[model samples]
Target: MTEQAAAVVDETTVAADLVTQLEYDRYTHEDPVPDWRPAKPFAAMVGALLLQELEDASDGWLHRTLDADPELAANLGFEPDNPPSRSAISRAWSGRLAELCSTIETSARQIRQLAAERGSPIGGPYETNASEEPTGSSKRTVNRLLRRKARDLLDELQTVVLPAFELDRPDDLVYDDEELLTLEACLGVTGTAANGGAETYGDFVNPDPALDDPFYEDGPSGETPLEAIKDLSPTDIAKMVNQGAARVLTRAKPRLEFETPVMLSIDITYVAFYGEREELVRVQGAPEDKSYDWCYKFATANVVGDNVHFAAGMLPVGHADYHDSDAYPGKDKSYRVGDVVRRLVDHVNDVCRIRIRRLYADREFYATDVFSTLEQREIFYVIPARRDDRVKRFIARMNEDVDGNKQVTVKHDNAVYGPVKHGGTKSSTETTLVSLPPDEDRKEPQVFATNLDVNDEIGLDRRWAKKQINRYSRRGGIETAYSKIKEFAPWTTSTNFSIRLFHFGFAVLLYDLWLLVDFLVQTLIDVVEVRTKPRVTAPRFRAFLRREVSALL
Candidate 1:
């Protein structure tokens, strides 16, 4: 402790001195110091804590004191009679301040214990043999604190999602909306499917047998949440879940530190369905031997980079419900791949409040309409090209046996292509295409379509093209993210689109939280080398959440 830290010992000079000591601790620490600037002054929080300690008041005393008196708030260094919001105060205390307070108090008590042991008798003879133990929430491990804060942040999603479906907590409800939402996240983190997992968790937490039934099971006789969810339309459910994802992006945007505009990746994922194909269900093509062909498809837009792959927006990809006779009964209602990209881009831009600089996608997004959409938005992108006749002709022009391994690079700056819709008009886009030599990953040549500068004056700009191609390779993170998203997604056999959509969306939310935690942990350990590798693995985070939330129950 320095002189500034020593000044915090006296109760009369506590709050301001405590702030000084905090500043001292930050400045004197090694590299990678915590980057936190509280919204409220630390002095006000410190003074409130000290006041509660002196008066032996309950947890509600801080807010009550600030609300009942203004003079004291001003004296404690809050903006004249304008105390911080209850949430702000709670956030401030729940963060690093709590650790600092614990440290300071413990250090002072240890000093007193040392004095008593040495026969100095400071503070009127402290007992050396007395056990010093933390009680209640303060006794929780660091993992518990982290899980509590994460779940608290995710609770905001419920406030946005539930009302979108016109849901509220009824007295006779089997589980409150928050509990169901947390249960959804719990199922996702634990990699268990819905009903069985819910029943197991309920058995541990719910003491009353009547209320311990799985509330997510699909049935007419049960009063589970699925009963209410089954009433919502597919559009309503999609909108509600997307709103929840947008809220997550809005919350995560502030934590990102970027030197360039964010890079985004858009791709579609399929969830296999075994039951009968109902409304909102689309047929996914597969081999004749495969059992399940019908599936629910969802498109997600994710930020793709070193340590920041958050699924920012998501939507279902299916044709409009026109009639029971034919899938194409309604021409105008079907959502195309281009429409998915445009909606996700606009939604992410509006909600995240950040300009998207580049977008990357797999060959499935190699259509002319997709290229035209990205170009129109002026967002640079790289999409692996489908080997159509024109693309194959360009690849055939290259020497077959160049450099003994048939590895030769080719670039075409002006290539025109179009899409043939189902009995609809075709549209074309003029873009650049790059054909690369085979490498260790694959034996065949890889072609990519992009608006990036990949041209060399005489031949392929090997260096520049290689650098851009390496950036395109970062899109692999999106696939890895999808695999991990599945890890967080609960196994569900339900064919109801609403339940499936909610489960997938909530799993994405948990995945984003897991990435956020890893990024934060990296910032504390090594500020520069972030997202290089995960500091907190998925299993560890899931375990933490499961233990903490179960303990809460």
Candidate 2:
């Protein structure tokens, strides 16, 4: 046997001897205990083999060493006709696969010390612009194999292994706080520090607004370097513009108007996954038409009040009604939009504890019935009225009065109006717009309508108008989330519906997991950094604790 294998065997022998001595000592002290016994010889031998497998230079080292040793070979009952090959030893190891898996898992958990020292990869694959290929040679295969094995092991634990460990009480099987924490550590976040890392969202925030301003000039010769860079190609400019817009939309923003009651902001995104050719067929009313120009819609709602928070509700367009010719009439068929908005408002009232007074949306949600429904439910709403002839005339008159440079505040008479042009067809509408003061430089306009009395003092300020516009614009963030999912997560832009659903679910789960990891890492950092001593020495402190416990034992 190699020296390492011998040492492992010796360590097991010493542990068994120590256990025997401890049991004897306890017996001498009249402690009530069962008779002590050494581990089975075969078990000890198997453990030694496992240790050698981990420590040896290659896969077949222990098997080769065993084959050459006559005594060891004889002990294992190997004959001339059926000598144990390396493959046989490998099969033997496979027989204790669960034990091996457990050992590897334990070793992986212990390697957190090394991982902490090395640090994790900041940002996900999408965020970091990483290549699609797996990082290392074995990484892909090993992760796949490990995940498959882990699922099987979890099933076995739930169905067989856990039940076998019967106890006096059933409650013992329940996961305790520490066990749950360990599980969170294992399955929660896989990589990198959450915050304070190079690629964290906070890192993107420029402290000085002047540095971020596009118009800012330093010792100007009538232009900054940014202006000088306009000489670049159109393709480059387009790429930069697209990327810049994505960055601006995705970056987190601060909450405004804390005293305002929470309201739902619902918006619909129509994605044409299939080309327009197939979509035209579905629109032409062929039920059995297997074409693909279908429109898929997702509606997301965010609650706006003291703090902006995500509301857990989504509305998906039904395939049947979405493409039905009779329901959606002409080219301006946008009934699905109204349905999604109503669902979001209903969800907010049902799920959120606070009283929601108003619902907010852009001109897309300008249905007369929508306003009526809210009024019937005793809810107020501030939706931008669609620009029809009447609204255009009103805006023109107001523009003349306020001279386009200043905001024109006006109130609409509470009178029901007639059919107005929407999408394409005309629909009967009844709503009035009361314009709040608008900031010309900010380009934010506010309009409100409800059956309830308007608080003119709070409503007339340009700041309020700006805040409303900002709140309404925040709904666009969901588009960024969708883009991130399509780019980073397992999701694809493919037309296969089943695969698409799978990918979407995976993306959402991934986002949730990322949030969970961020929370854990932030909590740990806060505890360590804000403590009495330097938090940077936490790993050293942990090592010290382990050593102290080992010495005590």
Candidate 3:
């Protein structure tokens, strides 16, 4: 037989075998299968391939490559007569994209754990064994399966793949016992407390030693009851305080108990981006007053306590002069800050059956309605009074009496005094200026207003009034929590889409969870890596990758 004729016969036989295999695969599956079930897995395989190369090639190029490669086309279950439509590929993504994200989050968590255990010089000392472990099994499984697929194809694409395309193993693959405990702490489930037991007592734990030292502390010269512990991990600090508070309440077993108050800080910031300089008219008649302009406003709020939270709620802007302006209706829409605050308050109240003694807010919460509502609920509140003419006059009067000394302290009863000014065009009301006592450096009098009247000479003492000021001053703690939310969570960024709101919320929750993990890791590090002082930065990512790789291995 001629060589050409023999080759043709062999090719025919190979083609026949391929056809037989295809038919068997399609027919053997009895599921209410898509007409393409046997071939469907092939589509998933190709989709994964596209994802791997997505960064480099255009979509068209990828499609063409798939078309040209015979083995790939067959593996994708593409028949000679029928090819997968672009829409089909696109549609498939919707079904699997979530799985991909879940995979990534899981991988990140696992890798962090592994890195903490092996790479960290810090020995594992912390651990958390909960009755119910946080559930992420489905996500982890999906990530593991996809990662395995990637590994199997590694050798085939080694030469073509760029170095950047290679995934790096996370540094936090292994977590010591301490790291595990930290994770628990961040999750708000670190230590177990006996419910209403004899051992439990209600007392705030003074974790920070600095709180005892007056000089080092930021506030007044007395030892503040709240201890300021430095160098402790945020997660650990939060957990320890919460757990201690919980235990204390359990022991007290009081008829009325109060849940620990979670503080959320809200702030507004504006950022402006300009491509080039733009001129603005200063006045219609004065050309000399013209100036160039570039500016915009971006307002955001950070709600932090055990977990970081955020909202894109509206903030009202109103002008006293323009009460009828059309812009006021839309631009000055009411925000839901009060609603959120109420919900938080309710949560605590329901859990502990104890009323929140007071909500501390800065001048922003000085709105009469807000104060009135809290008062109606029998909730005490300490909010800074807006510094209007009344406050200024009181300060001026005190200064005059003291021979130019700015400090003075006094008490007054009932009648509102000071300047009458309209704030936000709402109403014309008088602001009462009550003087507080002189502090160390300045004898100048500080002024404030409150509805509560102090008739008793001792009750009106400046020291008592100053205490109110100090208590409200602690509201700044909310700002610190806000900073952490923006710094650590990606969702807080303005660019995040609303579709991902729930996911972002979940991510923040996970971050809180990671903080607990970090506390445990830090504890372990203290024990194991203390001398070497090894540090792990991206513990979550590290734990995730390590877990996936371990599974594959």
Instruction: Give the count of colliding residue pairs in each prediction.
Output: 1, 4, 68
Scored against the true structure, residue 21 in model 2 reaches a CA lDDT of: 21
Q: Note the Cα lDDT for every prediction shown.
A: 0.59, 0.36, 0.32
Order the numbered candidates by TM-score, best leading: 1, 2, 3
lDDT per residue (tens digit) for residues 268-343 in model 3: 3222223332331111121232242332221222222222122212121111221223322224433323333443
For candidate 1, write residues 362-390 as lDDT tens digits: 77788766777788789999888887897
Q: Is candidate 2 or candidate 3 better by lDDT?
A: 2
By lDDT, rank the candidates, best first: 1, 2, 3
- Which residue pairs show collisions in model 1? 193-491
Model 2: what TM-score?
0.39
lDDT of 2 by residue, 1-553 (tens): 1222222322112211211121112112221222374221333234334334333223365555455655544444334233345664565456533344454334323322122112211111111111122333243543343333233222222222122111122344332322221221212122222111212211222223375655232112211211222243322322222222112112111112223445666655344454544533222222233344355544445554332233334444433433222444454443345555554566555432235666776566677656655766677667776667666556555432335553444454544432222322444445555554455544544555544343333325434444544455544544454443333223123443433332232233333222222222322222212122222132332222222221211
Per-candidate TM-scores read 0.66, 0.39, 0.35
Off by over 4 Å in 1: 1-175, 207-223, 275-281, 286-292, 321-334, 399-424, 458-460, 527-533, 550-553
Between 1 and 3, whose lDDT is larger? 1
